[model samples]
Target: MRSIWAATAMTVLLAAGAAACDSSSAGPAPAGGLAGSTASSSPSATPDLEAGEELARGLDVPWGLAFLPGGDALIAERDSGRILRLRPGGGTPEQVRTVPGVAARGEGGLLGIAVSPTFSSDNLVYAYLTADADNRIIRFRLDGGDPETVFDGIASAGFHNGGRIAFGPDGMLYAGTGDAGETSTSQDPASPNGKILRLTPEGKPAPGNPTTGSPVYSLGHRNVQGLAWDADGRLFATEFGQNELDEVNLIQPGRNYGWPEVEGDGDTAGGRYTGPLVTWPVREASPSGLAISGGTAYIAALRGERLWTLPLNGDTAGEPAARLQDRYGRLRTVQVAPDGALWLTTSNTDGRGDIREGDDRILRFPAR
Candidate 1:
């Protein structure tokens, strides 16, 4: 019961005091004090799924989810800085642009969306936002115009603005920050706020980072939303837990995921953290966006609406199976769609769940 749980009153999970304790209560979560072990929401042996369709709907708060190489996919609307482009068989999603000065407030706007693994010819595309003051990472081109600041100040708070951004597997560009609530800026390494950055795609600093020109790479985190890359590349992350566990790390670089002072797997009696390839129970799992194909690594549960698959053995991890629990409720972000299916997003409209009425969708499972 020690390892941090009262840090300035447990914040982050889209802060604002956990979105005002997530409206009223998302229930069931509290097993924190973890650092490992807790993958058995029952029903093992894998196989389980009979439906999944939505494709794309009204989409109000849909935050980040890149995947384009013809199959089309590039969504982001965390409060409407817009950036649609779903396409694939469903048609009608196409908005294609809109980023200018996005400051959309609370849990910040236009979060995560990457697609520039050369992006077919550098037509680029990258964003991780919350502007009006800070928390940046831009790069655009998909039809629109303007947007070229590769990295900016960071530290956007309405509640810990750590927006997730991905593009790893050596291609660099991995962001994941938050500490805007200032918990000592996650141990300030000259402050990049909570940290987990690695650039180069013009953002500079990426060449086996660990301080050379600095892009920090790894250093105590508190709100890293997700960044997958497994299949031997090993580098998973999905942190955001303060009042009782909620993590899923596996990152390496300058290592030191002990935030404010450690959350789930700490106390060798004195300081030193990094223990999570597992942990949930911050009201079930406020864990957001995270995906890995075939060998499993799903995890997209906002207050545990479900989609926690885990089964990756190699760098270690196995025993987790929750798949679509509350059906299609919260669960924001999860990709791997280029035909190989498995795309999810539906944050119940973001004011916090039960919205329905085309509330927020983009479901579609069946990942080989």
Candidate 2:
């Protein structure tokens, strides 16, 4: 059950968000604004629940968007294995660096990126990518210096290769990995695949992990694509179900999520795993990058082609409301920017969707 305070906060947030969405200008954006870019969508158009503008377009399968201190965004391109930096004031993107040895196969490639917690001082950036033999993470200087592998040897197949990384409130790095199409790996305690892992910046296991000498924070995840945390430090992750269901789970340390044995809410008793906070049919939500803001969880949906806002009350989630349904094709990520806005990335150019001329864009909602 939700607390009174949480419910009240949720109400205020929804009202404010709705007001902002409705008060947008109906006039079209400037004619020359989208010139020289592959931008088919109108930046002036207001989606159902949000008014958004295209920040950048014509990207090559942009997987992750990490905002830097000065408001520059570093976007990771999956197939091209490049990290492009886009400044705030509308200049052409600069290719900051290309990841070495990325295997850009199906469902794998240069994936998630996280700027170092001390990026202002250290200039380090971390990336998770599929290499020749396995999935691995490399930390390197932002100035294109040599890299060092922090962790490696996770299974990387053609599909189900999970790749989402974030820094938790404790400043430790957390990663969500997939089962790599190997269901058994979800239950394998020793396998790095299909688990949420906590580690130090250097790739060693964090000190207070659920198990000593191991980075495995939780197991039994099939294909976790997103991770976020609420104000109470409660962790949440979005997952891909094999065929029928998609899930947003409240992640608890050491808890099993019942990968092959259970899908959605199981009626069978005594399962050795936790049920997801909410579930969706596969067609409605192939859940991806998630963000928590003002007591609501904003989830990016791929197959659903919308954004889902799930109100949060403590550990429980309210009914989800779909936003921008099919207005933008295949939303890939939802990130809360430093300026209290939401950054959305489209996945239309990723070969899985029908693309307009100006596809694969970064969109921004000034207020959420």
Candidate 3:
């Protein structure tokens, strides 16, 4: 069956207007904030969305998407292990490179892609993939060379293999990993699984990390596939819950986000676990890729098949509004293009949903 609902952005925006105005629905304040400061009382305004156009069609389980300096995007296919490049205007995508030894099993495969922030000088493209032995991050150049392993040895499984990596404003590489179905790993400081790891470009633990010589930046995430930094340089992540709540968390270094121990705003009787800024029923928001623009976060939903927009004021987030509901089947990744357009990918061909004429496609929309 089709995953997303077929509704226009304006229609959903109008439908959610009432709910968006209600400050009570903004959900919990999450954990950490400036002392004695109150959350913004005014609701966040709805995004001005324009008609979307398909950028490319017929992708096979496209997972990771990154943009180069020239306005072209490099996308990764989860099962195919191929990297394809396409421009803003529609055309057949070109295969730039194919990663070798990629184990495309279950949720494992080639996942996230990132261009080195210093790409002008380094010409490096990074990828997070499930290799034969483990889930690892590797960097390679489009010009052709053996991919160099930046980091490795996270347990790999058919499911819960979180694979998203991005370079933080601090110039440190941040990776989100899953527990690989091993729940205990979420809370284990020694294990890289179920944690957001901070590492130097060469893959050593970043300086001033939460723990001395440890890459674990935050613990207790089930599966984190989306990472973005706001204008203020605060980190935000999208996490998948186990049949309960899906989360958009305001991430802080060294903070513990209750994963196996709790889901959503659960039983934080003590101040040990940080709560999510926003939570949605799992069916409504299997949120994956996230991008923030104009003080708003645009999240791509998988099972929910919609794009969720939440306004950000300071550290507090306003109520979330769903746009383009069911218009696309199974959204996977969303990124802000260099020209400020929002680029999205579909996951209908990723072993789920009803495939359409353009089963797996890349879409472009105006940035708000």
Candidate 4:
């Protein structure tokens, strides 16, 4: 086994031939990874965990992972504006659709994707992307059709274009938007950026929102990229902190999460703001995508180069455990497959990390 620091130091020198292996080839991964409780700030060696099977390779900045009705995966590329579909068993991914009007810039491009809950009837697929004018959510049919704009007017920038969308249990669309490098938008009620927007399938504000006739469900968020619901219908979101702490917040309608006012675990300003349930140093957890399975919340980390697991204890989150530390370069998106396996994607080719051969690949892990 190699030390995480050693692996990280040698990341740039990884052999091109090693990364050139196709998805059909099998490779041995580093063993004896490290684990620790993020809340306690302690790390220790854990058992030799399985490295999982590589599903596809040679991807270009894969960011989103959503499943079709038949269990096929639809992946969104952050820079290419292309959607690729892969089988559950692992093989070469086939291009399905190429989204138009994408303005790929710094950290901005095609981001998150979702399939309609009633795909059998409507066959609609939803996507959150950075368009030429703004960040927007669009829906199109996988069969064939021009993509229709479901919602628009969210701000976009080189960075902080929050682009994750999903459907809740109540059949409403939920989108997380970023502040677009403007600190004031996080606290502003009129701006859609830096807030969670809830809408109907037709792009109207859902009923029972915090404010009547407003799509804003929650406000005061910095840059939210991950959103998931627990078995009990609790919404958990992952937010990018400024320079110090990153956060995992339990979301509620119309709630204000301290942004410019505070970063993590700050003074709630006499209960006016809600604090995060868990916080980690930005280096340890630049968390991106989140998925909850069997009461455990799995977070995909980028700069940390690991997966963070947090157990759910009713309304509270337990200590987080790190997995695959430095085994892969940088993790971007994580999703629980329809058959209960964990699917993860690497972002080494995303321009910020060392580009290894065959980087930006997808891996499939066993069920939890």
TM-score of every candidate relative to the true structure: 0.32, 0.86, 0.87, 0.87
Query: What would the per-residue lDDT of candidate 4 be over residues 230-334, giving only the tens digit for each residue?
Result: 888999999999899999999998899988899988999998999999999999999999988877899999999999999988789899999999988899998
Q: What is the TM-score of candidate 2?
A: 0.86
Q: List, residue by residue over 1-368, the lDDT tens digit for candidate 1.
A: 11222232233222332211122222121111111221221212222244465665656688898878887777887776767676555534545566778888888888987988988786889998888889899997775456799889988988767788888878888898888788888877877888888999889888879879989988888888888887678889988888998889888889888877878776623435667778877888788899887578888988788888898887788888887688777898887775566778888867778876655767665432
lDDT of each: 0.74, 0.81, 0.83, 0.82
Give the Å error, residue 30, model 2: 21
Best of the two (1, 4) by TM-score: 4
List clashing residue pairs in candidate 4: none
User: How well does candidate 1 score on lDDT at residue 82?
Assistant: 67
Q: List candidate 4 stretches off by more than 4 Å.
A: 1-51
